[model samples]
Target chain A: MSAADTILFVAAWLGLALLVAAFLLTVWRVVRGPTLPDRVVALDMLVGIVIGFIALIAIRTGFTLYIDIAIALGLVGFLATVAFARFILASKGRQGAGVYSAGAPLQDTAPAPDATHVAARGARGKSAAKSAKVAARTSGKTSAKKSPKSLPASPAVAELASVPAASPAIAPGKAAEEKPSAKSIGKPANKSASKTVSKSTSKTRSKSAEKTAGKAVTKPGKPAKGE
Target chain B: MDVVFAIFTAILILGGAAFALVAAIGLNRFPDVYSRMHAASKAGTVGSGLLLLAVGVHSGELSVLARALAGFFFFVLTAPVSAHLLAIAALKAGYSMSDKTVTNEME
Candidate 1:
């Protein structure tokens, strides 16, 4: 056997060995990727490598049937790529532009009127009436402090004076300030927000891919290794 | 003559092996997805081309030789195109870049 032939024999064997290793790496990425889009990217690459390998094998074994595999790869791979991209995009609807689509948060259930508030107001009004009558009797001749605590008896009138205090104290201060919208109320607000962000980013990613691939790939004339 | 042909075939195969080895190593060692892709494309297309060339030489008949040649050229034409598509897809899928190679507007 010639030195060259020995080299070729060893090289082809090694080439096949390397391909095995590469395939495993691709598989690792495919399996371990954190997200759907990441796995799709790895799978797309793995398919391309597979097609190239098939083409090489056809040339090595002189089997045109293998070329059929390459052709099939070309057809199927493109479709699969598109499908995965669509899958990524389909998942983005909630993540981006549709963020507001989560709808308005429902208002807090109005607190039920309780006896305590009514009773407290009633007590204060009676005392205030008595104080006011005392004040009128004295006619400001003697020096005594007018107690504001002794307010009047009509419950609505007491509430009228106390509307600002009642309103502020009735509901939580901050929550009312930033009231959740109808849609977000009693709903998974955070989960939907995260989902929408993910989907829109995925869509942006696919759109960018379409742009990069817009060019025709240049195939240089250099001969491949063996022939 | 038989011995000579066999020896030559062996060497050609070995050359194919070396290129494949480099390609595989590149796939593993490259810093980012795009670089790994570059490795895969080069090794896959060109390494396959070499292996086929050796096969054609070993076969010796014009028809078989012609087929090998066609395969080599076909790989040359299509492998990069497919690889490019793959790389672009990876980039779109948010493959992180370790190095900023260039910032062309078309990118």
Candidate 2:
């Protein structure tokens, strides 16, 4: 064998060894990746490594057919990667149904209710009547703070006022607020205001809160019976 | 002439394998999916393309060489396109970036 032939033989063997190493590493990544995307990237690399292996084999075996095979493999790999991308996008919607999409919007409205709850708790430390009044006003104010442009004047504010007042002191306030939407109307005023704000800023959280309040008010006998 | 071609093919094979090894190491060592992609797609493409070129040179036939060149170009072109698609999908799907990532303009 000539010097060049010896060199080519050694180089082909060396290349094959390196490709085997690459294959193992890429497989490790595929198995260990924390996320789906990580595994996809690793799978993509595996395709490239396989192509390298195919080419090295062609050079060693003197079969040009492997070149055609490598090209076909490249085409298939590209298609696979794109399909995986589409799969990832489609899966995103399903993922959103569980936690992130539902919770993300709620984060905005959540703090508003939380603030009122905190204030109510602080006021309750002093007196129930005072805390009831403070909670009602704060909750109303929070819901009203957003979008002053279009207030549809919902009677839900009466319910909202009562909702935040966990104390029995709301009994008097509820009767008073119920008498005329005009009395507690200054603070936040209506459900439409809160609805619009919730829609523009966050929908699910405020909606959930409203649903809970509605349920609580609708079943007033439950609380009375419990007490 | 055959001797020279053999030496050239050898060199190409060795260089390609070295790049492939680098790509593999980088894939294992990178902190995030995006960085790992950078290693895999870029280095891996070059490594694979170079090996394809070696196949063409060793064959010494014009048609086989053309096929090898075509494959090499196809790899070079498609690797990045696929990587970009994967990245955008990953990002849109809400995969978190590495904590060590300094600045993320993609968000």
Candidate 3:
């Protein structure tokens, strides 16, 4: 073997070891990460390193299979990243609870998915990740981040809305004629009476519940339509 | 020339192995997540480079050496990029880095 060849081979070997070390570090972070996105990101890094290793070792073994492995990994990894980003977006309380009337859109008054909202969501991920870490550290604050997703359904709110504070929302003429009794008292309009629910009340906002809320915000034209 | 080549490969492989072993140990030994990352990225980079180089020397064929060199270069470029991205992720995820570490003073 030539002196230069020896040097180059040595170089390749050292690179392999370093990449392994980096992979191990990434693995540690993946397991230790407090939130879903962090683990996802770490997984991405680990996959990238795997591709790099296959390519390096292929050079030594004189086989084409390794490079093929690298190519396959690249394609699969891209798909995984996109899917993860969507998952993260879907988890945030996008809308309110319950199914919308067929014509109603989400966030009636809130502006469309403009560049600004997109940027804000991106920014929100960063802060949310920070919050997740904080949540992990404190453990006690876990539920605080979960309450908004669990807000009462719009249908429930609407039922509460139509009812008067003291009685059910019956036709006004008939409701007046009926004498009130303890057994047949009117349904109280508790919906409007207590519009603001404490966000701190619920914290375990699972994936499905957030989706339900996101779908429930169906005010057609109002920007902040009860989403 | 032949004797020198053999000795060089021996040293290269041995050093590369030693670093790999240390990084493995560090993963278990380090108390915190950030310190473990440091041990892995820095030591792992050097160790892998040497191991690949050793392979190139052992293979001795022209085509093989050329390919090994490409891998070597790729490793050199990507190691630090991955490390930096990992660090960004670590910070963004909020695993507290060494408080005294000045690398991210701006943050």
What ranges in model 2 sit over 4 Å off?
A93-227
User: In model 1, which runs have C-alpha deviations exceeding 4 angstroms?
Assistant: A1-16, A33-227, B89-96, B99-107
| Root-mean-square deviation per candidate | 25.9, 18.5, 18.3
User: At residue A84, what lDDT does model 1 achieve?
Assistant: 61
lDDT of 3 by residue, B20-81 (tens): 55665565566544565566566655555565565566556676556556655665565565
Write one digit per residue (lDDT tens) for candidate 3, span A102-167: 111212212233212222222234443332222221211122223332122223334433432322
- The candidates, ranked best first by TM-score, are 2, 1, 3
Model 3: lDDT of residue B5:
61
Better of 1 and 3 by lDDT: 1
Give the DockQ (C-alpha) for candidate 3: 0.07
Q: Compute the lDDT of residue A47 as modeled in candidate 3.
A: 56
Residue A34 local lDDT, model 3: 37
Judge candidate 2 at residue A225 and give its lDDT: 47
Q: Which digits, one per residue and each the tens of the lDDT, describe model 2 over residues B50-80? A: 9999999999999999989999999999998
In the range A1-227, model 1's lDDT, one tens digit per residue, is 66644554455566567666667776776665434444555565566557546644654565755645554665576568667665545543222211111001111221112111222222334443343333222221111123333233233233333432422212223323333331232212233234433333333332222222121111111111112
Which candidate achieves the best TM-score against the true structure?
2
The positional error of residue A201 in candidate 2, measured at the CA in angstroms, is 26
DockQ (Cα-based) for each candidate: 0.15, 0.33, 0.07
Q: What CAPRI grade goes to candidate 1?
A: incorrect
Candidate 3 wrongly placed segments (more than 4 Å) = A1-227, B1-7, B28-34, B92-95, B98-104
